[model samples]
Target chain A: MNKWEDNKAWFLILPVFIIVAFSAVIPLMTVVNYSVQDIFGPGQRFFIGIEWFKEVLSDGRLHEALWRQLLFSGLVLLIEMPLGIGIALLMPKKGWGSSACLVILALPLLIPWNVIGTIWIIFTRPDIGLFGAAINTLGLPFDHTASPFDAWVTVMLMEVWHWTPLVALLAYAGLRAIPEVYYQAAKIDGASSWAIFRYIQLPKMRGVLTIALLLRFMDSFLIYAEPFVLTGGGPGNSTTFLSIYLVKVAVGQFDLGPAAAFSLIYFLIVLLFCWLFYQALQAVGTGDKQ
Target chain B: MARIDLNEIRHSYKPSPKSDDDFALKRVHTTWEDGGAYALLGPSGCGKTTMLNIISGLLKPSHGQILYDGVDVSAMQPEERNIAQVFQFPVLYDTMTVYDNLAFPLRNRNVPASEVDARVRRIAETLELTNDLGKRAAGLSADAKQKISLGRGLVRSDVAAILFDEPLTVIDPHLKWELRRKLKEIHKEFGLTMIYVTHDQVEAMTFADKIVVMYEGEIVQTGTPEELFERPEHVFVGYFIGSPGMGFLECTLEGDIAHVNGAAIPLEPGYGVRASSLGSRFKLGIRPMYLGVHSSREACGELPGFEARVVGVEDQGFCRIVTVQFGGQEIKARINDGHPVAEGLCWLTFPPEKTKLYFNERLVG
Candidate 1:
């Protein structure tokens, strides 16, 4: 009777299991299959056990793309976290002004990723684009299509603009969740502005900030459409992030086996970093427990 | 410690308050002597918190001044006023150790390290938090955290006063007794001016030497607990101050006698003359404890007892409250556990000395 009851519990989960297998497990299995075989044509594949993995891991282009991807994500986190928190702190705590500010902040986030790229592409143009024409008017020789540095700057700006609001919104929610009494108590305790921020506001914001950090890290680490649309692996591949490089390997070069292996490695790296980041943040306020 | 004086303080949150109804605090004119324990007792939105905030300098009143030691400190900040406030919820630096949490206010004022340490240790010990001093404050129980918050308030000796805004609301019921006793001890030992705000009559009666009762943004009465119970200045006070509260009967004054329904209940010697000037319409207020319930006509004896139909009897462990229909209203009379309780009909006695008369919600005589 107990065995039957346990089996009945598993039966209830059959729908979820089937959905996961079809949507996730099956696609992942295809990737794993592709990663292990050397495909010449349809039905003409040979088992190549770890050869593709070895080749993909050792590729000089992949290593450069990996370094570039790390730097980009690191910069995004470094810039956005503080900027987002600062903006949230400056945002009005209540009233119509607060609502207006929230709407304005959400505008960039509402734009489609591809559209953001297209908008930035024109927006950073030297002649017709407002930002580009204004910058060029200062005679700085600003042109993203030609300069790798300019392309990086433009891409970073667009990424920051597109996603910083998410961080700010999260931080704002965290701020609002704090009871008004904490501030009242802090004022009575003679806490200075900096002390209030450090002891009360910052510690309270840790939960949402950790979420913001992990999300920004994972999303930026696997970023694709914006840069691909804006720079398109660019003039000499300066702006080519890991996702763009993976696409080049899979579609541009038609190296399915290598691309599959590279993708698995990419997923592992993001998973590893996200785990490390979450662990680091979670351990922060706890400090040394006795 | 400093004597806190609130001089005609009135406040409104609107940009320009044009009417009396717009104000949260209509008018508060009172002085709290230094080192006296006081509680602002009122229901929610009675402006008790607003009064506390105004005194602590957290809020600037729309009109009038707050004086600490007879010096106007209304324009100053809460920190500048040197006041400590414990909130309804425990407010501690979550990441800090209990010792650090206690030492925070002192440290912020640049108190010497040694003094801070000593004060923190003394407060932690007083609050029964010595062992938890090394633990992060966030990990402690709610009661322990509240102790830490109180410790922070007490750490600085220079603070003018410690204001508590329903600090025990979040505390466990069992722990609330211990914490309230601790506060009482602290108040007596330090002789610091402490103003506690609470809606609970028991908390106000026990923690404070004097209770300031408020209703609808007005200070109806300020007196010792005994005085408030014995002579409630307002109808709201009589209703709010006691468990089961005071029962009021509408009556008309006829010389020294009060006519209610068909019964003629006499008042105290000179009360009828006082009632005649106050107004003809009056209410006789009697505490359930004072109202006498008799099971038999013989028990009524020589007292001026009136006949009433018994409505219901409630056995409350230590005592029984007999609900009876007197005139047209239901009135409760508290009797001792072993006291004989009448079933259908009974006689109720309202002693002239114990009962009070009211006119227009104001105490008449």
Candidate 2:
């Protein structure tokens, strides 16, 4: 009668193990094999233990890219979270208007990442685009091609405009999930609007907000295509992030050993940060409950 | 404390209600004196909760004037009316400590910290939640969370009234009576007007000084438990307020006697005239407890009764309920455990003082 007393159930998971071995484990092992070797053409290679890792770790270019990536992700989160919540609150709650709003907001999310970069790049051309021309007319020296500051601003703005709708959609779903009784009770309790939001709406939205946070962090950390198309890691390497540098080393120069080493370190950093974020978010409800 | 009055209140969720059936609450006009504990008792969909929400200013009646001490507050919000309410399920701020949850209302109104602390402590001690005050509300058991909700409502001194919508429903069966007793104690100590809504008659009877019975969005009978038990003004009250309910038997009455199944039976002395005026649609209503039963015809001589055949006997621990057939009609009689088990013939009687007459669902006698 005891289900866990028998160990035969372990065999049921053999198919899952085999699939993971072929899909994830094998590719990971190949990367691991390359990270420790100095590969010069397909056949000319020598095992150089830890040398590529040391080189990738010490390179100042990798260090600069990591810093830029962190700053970009942090700024993306800071702008998107509150703006998304505000938009969600402002959205119409019911009727055909709500559907229309949802469709409009989801349009950007449906577009391919590279297409988004292309659209923004064309839209920001001062000579031919309305957005760029309006800023030039406003007498702000706004050219992404020549200035690093302008380039950062354009990339940050593009990222925010593209991703904020996803946050809003998540927050709206969370808001709708709240029961009506909580709001009625709050009104009876003489709660101000802020108190109602703080105690009721925000707490109810915590689960979705945490999901949104983790998704934004991971996706923005691994972002490559959109930035690569927009700036091409150029204008004096101002917006060069980890993913672009990794791609440049792996595909452009074809330095397989050093790029493999860089990728392994990059994977660990992403894994470590994501794990930390997940833990911190989960602890919000549990730690404060005591 | 203030006298609360609902004047000609009626509500319909439909915008263009054309008939009585469309309204959820119809033409309610009643007043509750300040500091009185009252219960609104009814079945589900009887609009008791709707009336409570209207009184607490959560829902405005489509046609009514809700007056607090003669001041019309029909358009005021719940907070403006200064009321507190406990819902069917406990609604505590889950992330807050019990102390903070209790202190929220006071803190919202910008009360001094010392006053908030003293009030919170007083209510927590009363609700037996002092030890758990420092603990997070989300981590506590359901009943403990419910106690925190009750404490939050009670902690504020400026509240006009407190409403409870089946607050004891989620509590364990054994704790229900204990919490009911605690609520009664709190009611007496505070002298605050409390409106408790519930579908269970026993809960209403035990807790409230006045029980308002509602049916089909209308107030049927409002009386003390004794009055409701003894003289139910409406037929629905007779059926809803008692276990096993009152039984009705078709009958025709002349001056001082009634004929049932072509057999003559004397009516109660004072009720004969009122009973005689009723139309042919008359019924004699009596509780099963008051229906007299005897094992043989010789047991009751010359008293007008039914000679019936015993069908079944249900021994209910302390009492026996005997079901009998008379004139092709089925009726049950409750007897004490000492009554002998009857075999074939039995006599059923209606006590003159206890029996009542109804004409078209309205009590006549």
Candidate 3:
């Protein structure tokens, strides 16, 4: 039997394509156009053909900022992933206590990034802040604006405090979705608590942990507001990460071509690292299957 | 292996259970012999799972001791007790290989690597998972995954008993048979005390040497499959054990005869004396297979029978289940395909020897 078929169903995706074109494609194309041309003003421009890319790629400051960004992302994942999972594990399974803990954990995440930085700045002020005053009172020289080490510490603390809750929430959800029977089976199988966590809990949380890892990695890689407001990339560029450094190039020096080229490289780097993390996580889950 | 005893065990989910109804398991007082296969047979929420968990040391009874080999283990953790359990669904570690999943129990107990490998391999071979031992457990089919879950239990040779809580519910019908057969073979080979929990009567009958029938949180009866069918200790056992179950009619006893709505049905001698001494009205219970259905009074011949209206006839391929309204109550009667069946009106003969008397939902001795 021949059935009547209409090709009009294909048109349903047109709206999505239109939205994506305006939201991502157009902006990306403009950035690409700016990266390849030298513009002195609104109407005067010359196609430079890869010169900006070469210049951005070879800049020593960009390389240093790239290294710094990599280190920051690495530390964020290293600290946040385990810390988040640990907190989630320690959280109450159910009851008013569980809800209370969840609300408290979400408090840091709900604060705006720049507001979090300001809160931390006041929290760590040497003259008036709790942490800064306490450290100086203890005979330690603590000033985020004066010392690079102090600035890096203050920025790292703010970043971890502001974002660890996201990872914790994801891990908590993963932990909760596991069926109770696994724990029962493990207990009856004579598994120790640590073994149960390693075999049952950890493996079951793989999907959410993968998401958490990638999200935290990308978010930390693109971090700007909190660190910028907290230290303003001060103390001699100690905390001038890739995003902060890029903002300096684009808005501070107003180097449109180089900044556009830098933005494209940054996007590629984030995409590449996320892909690598996802593949690694999936391989661990699938074992020798693929 | 150990003989597990539930010494008057009772449990309640409520914090302060003041009455019997508040208890999930009102009372479960029975002993499971060592090296014996037993099934906790019951409908859902009949305390079968509660009993199984108590025996496995997963749930502590609210009142009473759980004894393993004459030692109290009521307060012990599941891991502290030498037991293994499989849940209704397969609970294999998703990221581990089949071999690793099987070896996990032994490894956690600090078993030597060489011994763990040998035991894991042997169990895998027994479960016919030797070929797939290196594959991750998550990629396996549901039946294969269940086999892995069973293998994890089987790998530990020193387990006091292995409890299965409807482990075949997740398997396909064809695979269920194979897996059940494997379990029976494992039980026979190991001689491990096994307690299986299921609401499926056929599964209970075939898998267990003894069936503990539960009803409304009480152990109504415990007996061999034949005893459960032929001499049910409780009305519930008679009702729950058979294919088309037992038919019950409210009646009063009078000198080896049971009167149901002015109709008298003969019973075995001494029932009248015993039921009278007990001094209460009782019920007449008979299995569907034994309740003979005839077309006419002449067909009943020398034996007395009651008149009933044929409500429906269901053909079950090999036999027919005749539903009849007898004495203002609906009851079923099973007839062979070769037997002549009546339409609209029929006579039901309760064979004197096959009939049972029940007093207050319990068998009259």
Candidate 4:
């Protein structure tokens, strides 16, 4: 008993821990090192003493990208959450039809992110795409190719189509987890349709909805592939969210120091928001318990 | 309160019930008096729950009408029918407080806030849940949650009837008795038209003023507990209603004398005609508690006793259950603790009036 139990059980998990530390911790350490230093080449470096952080914070591009990212995440969450819940409600509760509906809804989520971007890019072309042709035929000078407003609409629509399924799937699982007894009780209570939704369905979906919101928000904020392929940050940086802008600075302009600092700031913002979301969820759970 | 009538309710899931087997609930016609407590009691998959669901409007009959107070409301939804239902499992909203769970139905109907508060408090007190009123339902124990479910159904008194579908299944064994007693008190106080469905005979017998015994999609019998005990209309009812149920042994009847394994037994006159129509498949049913055991042939000749081999003896504190094998058959005899009969050989007797005769799975009068 005093031999510390050998603890071989932890040895079984050592490989996983090592892999995660290498993938996440090592790169994070590299980013931190770069953020604090001025790098001249692969082998040469100098202490910058937070100068790059000051420069990155003062930059106007960072502000613009931050605002755009926030707006996109907010809009995506607002549109997807309720739309997903509504679709889930309309889906059949049982039988072969329910499986068919689930399969159809799950089709969009199966496609790769880059493929989704490519598909939307081709599907929204002015001359060749059905949507673009229909809009042009309606005599509205709609050209996502050259217009910032049109580009933003195209990206938003693509994001909604690609991500709304996730929320819907989560909501569907939540709805299915509810035992039929609750519905029977509601019926016996003589609850109106609205009252049942308000008092029973909504409260039951709280846990899953929190997860859906957080997932959709984080994904929308960090979205790159779809918008990158669709707009390429075109129409003078109108659709340039923070992820796209950070990539442009690090890879395009080759300013690793500022880019690393900017990346750390971006990570902090996400961390702060996620922490806030988690805190809010805990509060709701505690309040419910009381 | 209203008298509800199920008029020739014959329900089938498919387009047609081609054979008798296809009907989940065969034709059932019954009447529940106003402010009367009734129980639909049956074994699992016996169509008792199907009948209850039909009455609750969760399922519509393939043919026939459900009338409430002489008015047909067959096409109405459950809400339109104005009934309360408690399900097998607790169905309270886990996110709401115990008080709010009880107040939900009242608030849904837009009851006055003061009345809602008073009613919720009263129900909570009755359920012994006043201390848990402010606590959310999720963290409550299973019995507490079930009590909340029962309270929710009972909160609204304006409903036409309160239907309970095995509501005590999740309740603890010790608490089940308490809740059953509380339910009886509530029934007497409010005099609501209540329909309880359970497979448990004790719950049914203790709770219902009138019990409807159902088996294999048909209403075999409907009567008070005593009526069910004394005169079971069907062999299934006789076997289903009592503990250790009714023991069935093969027997043949001819001219007022019943023969079991060639052993002649006397029967009341005129029971011969009813037994004669029954083909070779005939049986005698008697409750175990009504059986008497003897140590020797001393009481055998005068009391119409039969010789049997004792297979086992169970000491039940107040009494002993002696499992006896006789005439290539097994029977249970419940005897007072003072009686002593060895395991291998014994004598048993069935009081003539207490014995029930069955022909082709039905009781012969």
Q: What DockQ, between 0 and 1, does each candidate earn?
A: 0.66, 0.65, 0.65, 0.62
- Give per-candidate clash totals: 0, 0, 0, 0
lDDT (tens digit, per residue) of candidate 2 on B50-148:
999999999989998999999999999998999989999889887788999999989988999999999999989888899998888888898898888
Candidate 3's C-alpha runs over 4 A off are A1-7, B277-280
- Residue B194 local lDDT, model 2: 92
Q: Identify the candidate with maximal DockQ.
A: 1
Candidate 1 CAPRI classification by DockQ: medium
**What lDDT tens digits, residue by residue, belong to model 3 across residues B1-365?**
99998899899999999989999999888999999999989999999888889888888889999999999998899888889988888899888888888998898889999999999988888889999988988999988998898888788888899999998898899877877888899899989999999999999988999999999999998899999999998888898889889989888888998999889999999887777878668989999999989999888977896889999999998999999999888889999857767669899899998999999888887
- Candidate 3 collision pairs: none
* Reference-based TM-score of each model: 0.94, 0.95, 0.97, 0.95
- Expressed as tens digits, the lDDT of each residue in B1-365 for candidate 4 is 67899999888888867997899888899999999999989999988778888888888889889999998989998888988888888887766889889999899888999999999999999999999999988788899988999999899888888889999999889999999999999999999999999999999998999999998889999999998988888988888877767888898878777788977767667788766766766788888888778888786767777788999999888878889898898988777758677899777777788887888787887
Off by over 4 Å in 1: A1-8, B14-21, B295-302, B337-339
Of 1 and 3, the candidate ahead on DockQ is: 1
Instruction: Report the candidate with higher TM-score, 1 versus 3.
Output: 3
lDDT of 2 by residue, A72-181 (tens): 99999999999999999999999998999899999999999999999989898887767887899899868888899888988988899899999999999999999899
Model 4: residues with Cα > 4 Å off, grouped in runs:
A1-10, A95-100, A288-290, B14-16
lDDT of 4 by residue, A128-236 (tens): 8888878888887778879999999999999999989889989999999988777877887878888778778987898999999889888998999888888888779
Winner on DockQ (3 vs 4): 3
TM-score of the second chain in candidate 3: 0.96
